[model samples]
Target: MTNTENQARPIFPFTAIIGQEEMKLALILNVIDPKIGGVMIMGDRGTGKSTTIRAIADLLPEIEVVADDLFNSHVSDYDLMSDFVKNQINRGKELLTKWIKVPMVDLPLGATEDRLCGTIDIEKALSEGVKTFEPGLLAKANRGILYVDEVNLLDDHLVDILLDSSASGWNTVEREGISIRHPSRFVLVGSGNPEEGELRPQLLDRFGMHAEIRTVKEPSLRVRIVEQRSDFDKNPEACIDKFREQQIKLKENILLAQSKLPNVIIDYSLRVKISEICSILNVDGLRGDIVTNRAAKAFAAYQGREEVTLNDIKTIITLCLRHRLRKDPLDTIDSGSKVDRVVGEVIGDV
Candidate 1:
């Protein structure tokens, strides 16, 4: 984000959000291990998709960015952040330190491609007779979260660009006489109403996991969620204080999960079993199998388990690989239900 947008921030706190435990867990899991890929939340409207992202604003670690660098590139990590920042001395813009938080930037549905990738500042270059590049949303999203609302409705061209940049971990532009390459290594979080539109398969595969969120059906749970949200909205400080302990515990859990993830063991037999599951489902890519195993291992670690087991694999199969599966054209399909049934027959019985 630019120096201007940094001045503006989200109003809600992540811990105070309510009624979407699965969605919340999925995001937290991604944060603990970004290798889990990224999260895609498709559900009904008003289910706190946007709110969940906004609330996470205060939950991330504060980072040090280049003073005026567009991508919020880390100052100390400049050796690896981007070529644009590396060539600052030749460009005559002195690199200064400007520490900023891990941002959660929202890309609106109506935003154009130029605005996202950035366009040449004709006024400055022509009138002043000098070259300058204007920063866009991607620049601000580096090393943070890039949130796209109603992502299914995004234009096809934009979707292609997003897929490429997200997969490559950088964005390169050669237009308007400005050839620039910069880092764009943010976790892509997208929420949309699947009924309204469908996400392109190419882009869908880019996301690591798919989380389906629905409003709470239980009256008591729904009421509690509303009451808590209302109470927090009315008195922010008091509500934050009450939930401070939960937040602290949650952060600690995340740190523990990160340390334990690499240590979680997945044996050859289990790897073969995971591959069998993917093969049975006719999933097309190796990425699905890889992500499923990683997520299962991560889940085991999160629950403080030392060894990977059948239950962990079963629990995370749907979250990890369902979105990447090939859809059955004739059958009225429930991907999650199918994943569960396969686990029950194959892994559960074992």
Candidate 2:
């Protein structure tokens, strides 16, 4: 797409999304620290799960990439490039750069492995007797967002591919006498209705946060949602214009949080609390401990604070570790409430 077309594409305003604050905050925090990993959103249909994700992507800042590069390789990703790309950079040639929107790539349910991870150029191989690597969705998604709608319905093998790529930050494609690797760093956002099916445990563990959303219950809020959506459907451009200022402020806030993230401090006591809470809840692996710490730090940065606070952890505990809980048949409490109770017992109320 041309830059002009990209800029002109209308998106629902992030600030105007009626509710689903948990999902919105999770997305914002992921943008701040992709290292915190990605989020899994389980909710009812038409609860704005996909809409909120797209809105968050729309508000993200543009990315800088090597102009004309097939893999959307940024300067930092130079080391992970294919030998062909590396050769171009090795010569005394200045690489041109271009600014593009942060990719929000959809991983459709039926996508083939070759299409998802790219494949060999069969025609080029036949005609030129040379092997060339074709890029895939993962390559395009580098330094951006990879969204999977109805993620629970995705095939197990494809789920494994996503997990592998997410864990290693690399997507390796090996075909007939050809292999290539590229940076595949991205915030993996998956949304699905729980009533459809349960996610695989391994894949669930990979996600940094989990949030469940529901339909709006308040009568007034529901009316407002209807009105705003109707207005946007009537004139998308006008709705975008109306929320332009708030969107800009939110974008600026994210940029500022990113800059501030490195300096945000996590005190030892908070670290102890994170571990203690995870231990109390019997969550497996250190992923819970690590993600909670990173999330709290990001929350501090988002709030323009230099140090982590108990409140930061309190606000984010459910998002960070709810999906990590093991089910107990005897315990009737929902996982979210269990997390709250455990957190309260371990750390007291913030």
Candidate 3:
């Protein structure tokens, strides 16, 4: 497709989305601080999981990247640059740059290891003595968002590969004796229906946060959602125009949060209580505590605050700890509620 045709494709505006506030908050926090890892969204089918994810990509401001780079390598940030780009920079080459919309790559369930991780042409290497490496989805996903729909249905091994690359911020493909490594940093967002299946806890815990959404129950709200969707389908341009102001404001807010995140501070006592809840819940590892702190700070930054408050932690604590709790097949309590209960006992009522 031509660039114009691609750009012309209409998307539902993020601000126009009516419900699923938890999912939206999780996505925005991850965007503000990707080091919180990524978010895993579990919800009923048709809960706007995919729609909200796509809208987030559209809502984000354009990013500057190296022109003609396969990995969308940032022109200036060394950590976001690919190996090839870094080499060119090290050699003092003048790099051309351009601004483009943030990339959002969908990981297909049927993708093979090589297709996800790129490949090397060993034949060319042995005969012509040149390593010809083909870039894959991970390459394309660098410095953007990698979304996996129906993530629970994805093969466990493939999920492992994804989690590894996301955690390490790099992807390496090896063929024979040739190995090629490139930056694969991106926020990994996965959504799946709980009725279909659940991700293995080990893999799921690697996700920074988890947001559970249900289909809207209020009749009036449901009607509003339906009407908004219908309007978008009939006249996308008009629907987009309707939300233009809100969209711009939200985009600016997200950009401002990203810039202010480093300055947002969570108090020592708040950190202690965060871990205390995790410990009481018998959560595995330190991920729960660490993510909760990071998410709280991100939320504070999003709210244009420099100091993280108890309300900030309370707002995001459940999302940070819900999935990390050990599952008891016989326990009937909702994980989110259980988290709230523990938070209440440890931190006192918010």
Candidate 4:
């Protein structure tokens, strides 16, 4: 199939969809701050996982990027490599520029190991190529999002490669008689059903937060959803007009949240409360605490608040750290209940 054929496939818009407010909020939170690592949406198939992500790709504001920079590296960045690009840029080079909304690049399950990292051009090298470098999925995903559907089913080696690249912000390739390394930094987004299989603990830990998305059950809401989806399928132009107003509102909310994140402060007592809560529940590592704190601030920012209160922390603690906590076979406290217990005690203490 041609690239034209592939691009013709329809994408669902984020704001046009109905219900699933929690999932929408979580995704928006990560978008406001990519430092949230990325989000993991775990649930049954056909739950609009891919749809929501693709919609977000379209909804995001266009980012300003460097001129012809591999990895779509941001123009705002200094300290770039590429002696050629760097020298030209330093010499006061103006850009051949275009604005692009963030790309949501997919990683298909069937992708080969070499295809992902890229391979050496043997024919080109032997001819006039002089070992010409080619781009890979990681290259396309930079300054954007790398989405893996059914991520739990991905090959072990591929999972390892992604985890390493995610941590270091670059992928190193030394294969096929060539040594190539490039920046591949991105927000790693993955969605899968937990029943099919579990992602490796190490890979799972890379995700900053996890959220559950279930099918909406309201009859009126469900009917509206189907009608809107049908309308979108028929005359996307009409559906777009109906949804764009909501989209603009959401986009404004996201921008407000981002701007508010820097000034939103968490009290010291609340910090101790969070640490104590995570400790009581035996959550592993410091990332949980850090993410919970940030999420609380983001939540407050979303609410147009200037500071994070204990209530804000309570609401976000589970959303942030629940996935990272260890489960007990003997004890019956589920992640949600565990969070509630901790929140209650912490609030009492504070």
| Global Cα RMSD, each model | 3.8, 2.6, 2.2, 3.3
lDDT of 2 at 13: 93
Off by over 4 Å in 4: 1-10, 79-84, 176-179, 327-335, 348-350
Task: List residue ranges in candidate 2 displaced over 4 A.
Answer: 1-8, 76-85, 327-335
Q: Which 10 successive residues of model 1 have the least lDDT summed?
A: 326-335
| RMSD of candidate 1 to true structure, Å | 3.8
How well is each residue in 1-350 modelled by candidate 1, as lDDT tens digits? 68967775435667777667768877887777766777889898988898887767567657778776667776557533667677775578767887676777888888888778877777998999877777678877777788988898888788777666666777877776789888877777888987776776666877888889876789998898889888877876788788788777877787788889888998889899899888887888798888888888888888987688888887778887777764543322245977877767767674
Best by TM-score: 3
Per-residue alpha-carbon lDDT of model 3 for 1-350, expressed as tens digits?
78878785788999999978899999999999988999999988888899999999989988899997888998888888888899999999999999988889999989998889988766888899888887889999888899999998999999999999998998988876778888899999999988887887888889999998998999999999999999999999999999999999999999999999988888899999998999999998898989999999999999999999999999999999888875653332255988999889987866
Candidate 3, residue 138: Cα displacement in angstroms equals 0.7
Report model 4's TM-score to 2 decimal places. 0.88
Model 3 compared with the native: what TM-score?
A: 0.94
Q: In candidate 4, what residue range of length 10 has the lowest lDDT sum?
A: 326-335
* Model 1, position 226: C-alpha lDDT score: 85
How much lDDT does each candidate structure score? 0.77, 0.86, 0.90, 0.76
Residue by residue across 144-194, what tens digits does model 2's lDDT show?
Answer: 899999988999788888877876788888898777878888899998887
Candidate whose lDDT is highest: 3
